[model samples]
Target: MNTDARSHVHALIDRLPPVQLAALETILQSMLDPLSRKLALAPIDDEPFTEEDRQAVAEADEWLKDNQPVPLENVLADFGLGMTDWETMAKTPLPEETGKRNG
Candidate 1:
């Protein structure tokens, strides 16, 4: 983390009441478990935001909010492989035919 971010966190912690500070300490310590510690140490990746993805997510959220018909299964099926067929798909070769050894 940057120096500015560290200063900001310190400022917030310094302003907390005794009870709130204890609660925050408890929550922070709980996150230090073996599995959670590994997750916390993982690097954060930045993904570029695309207009198409933003639009799709907004539409899906609106549909769910209004209790409208949302075709999630069909949308997922169009990804070409289903849950059971994922292993078979992983073993299949790519469409490109460049790599081959003719005996």
Candidate 2:
């Protein structure tokens, strides 16, 4: 299967004219985003982070490394959740708890 796919790609490249071939090569070399608006086979976006964001990320990473747990079913139920709940939580607006908590 791999050999067949590779041969197919080679055949497509062989059929292209010199200018088109060079354009294809340029696309291959560029770190294009796949999720971008373009129809090309590269990524869409690669967001760079600020130093504060990076520091917060490092702190979160260390926290997770020290204290992650396999949550029990009862705990999930207490949070009014199922498997999809976590994914839903990700889509919601950021909570005010990140800053100073209100009484």
Candidate 3:
């Protein structure tokens, strides 16, 4: 941002009461949430998949086509978690848990 715009934001923040500041934080997070979710779901890179990766994905797709897909709730239950636990993790995943790829 330009210096003047940043200065204006700083001034506004300085004048906000704690409660108002908290509200502003919530508003800001709401604004950012959609973009953050999109980024999280986006592919990491534009590179073509390796042959092994392609084969693995193809196998997974074929398996899913033939077998009944497991519900997310069932999968979570296998790990002793439920919908609430998954939702909580989704909202605020740990840094180490973010952007991980499984083989």
Candidate 4:
């Protein structure tokens, strides 16, 4: 690592506005986190949108308009699960989250 370059980055970060920090955070995450890097580099889906896709969206909207909203917990309870179950299946923290950004 270049100590001078790192000092320059720290200086630039210290000078950045709060609103601009989110963009910087995203850039840094994409650089250090493998998942973020992969996603950032992933090819865009360019398939043409069809009438069937529109119809399906319309049907979903109509269903939402006609039905009462169900809470996530109620739906999960039907399958003998809860939010804690989701937590157990959650992905491990990103390198940045674990302070392992050098990767």
lDDT of 1 by residue, 1-103 (tens): 9999999999999999999999888668657554444455657867788999999999998888879673755655898656567655444554553387566
Models sorted by lDDT, best on top = 3, 4, 1, 2
- Better model by lDDT, 2 or 4? 4
Stretch of 10 with least lDDT, candidate 4: 86-95
Q: RMSD, each candidate, Å?
A: 13.3, 12.6, 11.2, 7.9
Q: What is the C-alpha lDDT of each candidate?
A: 0.73, 0.72, 0.85, 0.83
Candidate 3, 13-102: lDDT as tens digits: 999999999888867776689556556566889888799999999999999997998999999999999999988876786665578866
lDDT by residue (tens digit), candidate 4, 1-103: 6999999989999999998998899999999876777688778989989999999999989999989889988988999999897565344554666776673
Q: What tens-digit string does per-residue lDDT give for candidate 2 at 12-56?
A: 999999999998887765545332213454365687788999999
TM-score of each: 0.34, 0.30, 0.50, 0.53
Span of ten consecutive residues with least summed lDDT in model 3: 34-43
Show the colliding residue pairs in model 2: 33-42, 33-43, 33-44, 34-42, 34-43, 34-44, 35-43, 35-44, 36-44
How many residue pairs collide in each prediction?
A: 0, 9, 0, 0
- Candidate 3 residue spans exceeding 4 A from truth: 1-43, 46-48, 93-103
**In angstroms, how far off is 95's CA in candidate 3?**
4.9
How does candidate 3 score on lDDT?
A: 0.85
Model 4 root-mean-square deviation: 7.9
Model 3 residue 32 lDDT? 81
User: After TM-score superposition, what is the CA distance of residue 86 in candidate 2 from its true location, in Å?
Assistant: 6.1
The regions of model 1 sitting more than 4 angstroms off are: 1-31, 68-103
